[model samples]
Target chain A: MTVTMEDVAREAGVSRALVSIVFRDVEGASTATRERVREVADRLGYRPDQRARQLGRRRTRLVGVTYAVHLPFHGELVEALYAAAAPTGWDVMLSPVTARRDETTAVESLLDHRCEAVVLLGPSLPSRALDLLFARVPTVVVARSVPRRTVQVVRTDDAAGARAATEHLRSLGHRRIALVDGGRAPGAAERRRGYRAAMRAGGLDDVALVPGGPTEHDGEAAGEALLATSPRPTAVLAFNDDCAMGLLNTVRGAGVRVPSDLSVVGYDDTAVAGLRAVSLTTVGQDPDALAHLAVTRAIALAEGDAASAEQVVPPHLVVRSTTAPPP
Target chain B: MTVTMEDVAREAGVSRALVSIVFRDVEGASTATRERVREVADRLGYRPDQRARQLGRRRTRLVGVTYAVHLPFHGELVEALYAAAAPTGWDVMLSPVTARRDETTAVESLLDHRCEAVVLLGPSLPSRALDLLFARVPTVVVARSVPRRTVQVVRTDDAAGARAATEHLRSLGHRRIALVDGGRAPGAAERRRGYRAAMRAGGLDDVALVPGGPTEHDGEAAGEALLATSPRPTAVLAFNDDCAMGLLNTVRGAGVRVPSDLSVVGYDDTAVAGLRAVSLTTVGQDPDALAHLAVTRAIALAEGDAASAEQVVPPHLVVRSTTAPPP
Candidate 1:
């Protein structure tokens, strides 16, 4: 027969209440009693009934993280979060909110698991849905910023990153700069706003903005569009590294030399940017640092410290082989 | 006072047993009764006390997945598993096991959360640890082949995939081919055996074997080593896509043209392989299909279908711009 908590208490020569307190690690149980109970329980091969304990405690210590689509760097961030949370005795659960599955269902499904907190990465959920989710659990929104103050936000400063990219190009004497805008993606809007703000601030507001997506194909399309322009921008600022790669290949395929014919800048200095073949100049965000901050803030909120609601992380530019002064 | 199950039952004009059966969606509950209970609960704004219900069932419908390291593709597989399991009313929890935290601690931590089953992805644990895990709960092993008959196994046909990669190179007029090996990884041994068998079968047993790892840096190092050989290999088969990319970059950096000076083949046609810039010739394993199969099989095992212990999925090769006739 399977052993019970009562059996464990009898084996340890302790009262059932003491055994309960020790197993639960609740206050009022002395360290000596706790250690003794654990020793006897280990010797007896006793494991607390998880369901019973969870019911009594009313918390799961499980947090749900949802991503809109599958991207490699996004996966890296999730891995970082997992590494950060594991040491804190919390586990992260994944839920992919695809177009087929609406945001409400995703949030409801996580709620059903009794997760004490949630972290949404590049979520497709509308603001109302986010408001509803925040009402249900302590939530940390990553890679996206919402207007509400109820939810905590953790994101790389896209506007500042974009400005740095523009200023880098300007410093290289590239007066004719082009922006490949990532249309309607979670971070795209903020990035676009940053690019525009930076261009205007740098007296380059006349620079063209080409509509694009986050994929390399978008970069290719943007390259084609730029090539057709009467006077192609000597330099291009792509949406992200993937898009920059697309632009690089497209330009190279057309016999255009990088940094000689056209300088290019990418964002999210992913592994691809540092590749010897692709040596892309891009903006870098420390995923590990961001993940640590988000998870730490989440634990605090889960532990009932709800006053801290927002945190912003800074981004920096990494110079590589892809950028040079315009000829 | 917070509303209880009894309060919900009274409000719905149903017995407490009927309310529970309806909420749990037990097989015995009729559709009409289920609909009535749900409507009443919704109207009364009654949210089921998840903790209390979790206690009664002794199952959280949560499955914990543990990974030794966070490789890019592992993230895709985890996301796929989450998407697959969430629809079936099961949530996928992640436990990132580090060198500091052993497999036993990770497994026990999941057990403490009342996970219905556990899946270990590319675990580095010894067979004895695996045996202990399987004894505790329904367990599934992914990307690893274990000798134990009790634990269920889900893995790609790496041997077959490697054989196909080698044959593809041989068929393309490549006589001097080298295999960049993934040393000591779970599936690496099997893949190495396959490559050797295929080379011998093709009457090319004289081919070189270069030691490597799953990372791009490893690929670059292998490329340097191959370049040092007297008659450098005209064709290279890398351990995986990331490694292949590294090799491509390193060779190109040394002024070698891909498919002209060296034809390259990669294993695991990940999303990066499909990128226009990479266009990597590699082996393809359907991550979504594998994840779906693993989760379904795990749930079945947890639900008392312990008869089947192993399931194998086939791998296919995808030819892209990277492979051609040897110089």
Candidate 2:
């Protein structure tokens, strides 16, 4: 059984109203009485319910966020969210969707905290749940496409990003380029569409799509599988920077030189891609634009503006040392 | 500017108790009345106070967590914390401390959610603030040492871990080993102490301590500086895996082969260290053990168990491709 305010009141020989006033930090409570009430509450393991207090307030000034802890690119976007929220006098509360916890658990906690609005990054929730969530709170979904006008959305043009990466590799005179797929990740299917379109555009008859997940291990496995083929691809475009790093390292470990033997391109252009040693050719998502749009839309909805908006930003190719004319 | 339940009651011509029951999803309200009240509430943008309802309950079953979003190693430990909290039937609420958001903001949000206790990972708060926080709730500090008996603590033996890394390099016929510092991070000072003690114990008179920070860029800078010396050190032990990766990549980019020209060792054998592409030799902190102890201690303290325990776990070395007999 949990301790209650009533229990604390009884223990401290005070009325429940007095205990409530003290817990709320109101001026009605005297100092000695406040100290005594706090001591009694602490002894009884009682905490004043914060959500209850929030109900009586005019504004929460809080933006609920859902992000994956393991995704490096997600971390960058979250930092950007803080900056965007700062000027608007809004603070962010993060609820991480980890391997052990599902997205529902994460989102529910945000609702329980009475966050004014929500921002989801690369959310994997079903459309129905997302719809329900948006209906419950002002929501802005980032880096994924949902039905138009269902809720606000800010996403990169993933297909264009993939196409640019493929075209860059093709322009380097590489005929065979493989794409390490992101599996069923938010932008995976769109990126695949872009890759295929670009391959056909370049007049390449053969297109290879390797099975891969979002992690570095998946990229390593994909690299190994691609290398074992009778006719290896001359270049590879990975799912993201992490997968790209895995593929790049695997090939280099097998005594194959990067760019000189096999050119590689990664997506997301994360911090890792720009590392002096990794210097990967990749596609870039405009985080600043994405952050600005998401925050603006979220705050608008929270303030009861109730206008649904959808914005798609283009991704650009970042040419680094990872690509070269195929050997 | 927020709508209250009283406003909803007046709009729907219902009693306050009826409105509360409808919002709470409890009995004593007809379907027609519930719908009417809900419609009015929605129109008014009124959300029921969840925290107020929670005040009547015994347990939130929540453990608040504070972490740095950008730290990859911190992500690993958070995953471990979730797993550790699972069997105990507790859920975690995360508040990320990003570049734009300070630790105080993160911690206060946790308290607002009425979490039973707080678990801080690599917190950078002042000692006085930490003391004040612990006084307010059951707290467990990880990866940083605090005054004994003030609060429960679970951290790796940093000095020992650093000493072990130094000794391992020394045993590999490397007399000129330098320490790349983590500046003033949680475990940096202790690790530096261990490095110095180990260097002195190894009978090496000339010890090199390089100025480094916790990021990969800092490591890269230190690597470049070290390499510019007339007779560069044979081996370098970096502040953490990020810094080590920075140093390793810098040297490798400059055509200095690992284990042949410059052997590198990183700390905190993070997920990155185990990647085949970056098989870094580093010290391992048992995240599972640390997580289990921290959660257990936190729950106990929350339950009013007054016993204060401080535990220091051992750090072991994992030999990988980054380190070998120095040339």
**RMSD (Å) of each candidate, 1 decimal:** 3.1, 8.0
Residue A114 CA displacement from its true place in model 2, Å: 4.6
> How does each model score on lDDT?
0.81, 0.86
Which ten residues in a row are the worst by lDDT in model 2 chain B? B49-58
Clash number for each model:
0, 3
lDDT of 1 at B48: 75
Clashing residue pairs for model 1: none
- Fraction of true contacts retained by every candidate, in order, equals 0.38, 0.67
Q: Give the per-residue lDDT of model 2 (tens digit) for A134-165.
A: 88889899998875448788999999999999
Model 2: residues >4 Å from true position, as ranges? A1-50, A58-62, A87-91, A114-117, A128-139, A146-152, A229-231, A299-309, B1-50, B57-63, B86-91, B111-117, B132-139, B147-152, B299-309
DockQ of 1: 0.44
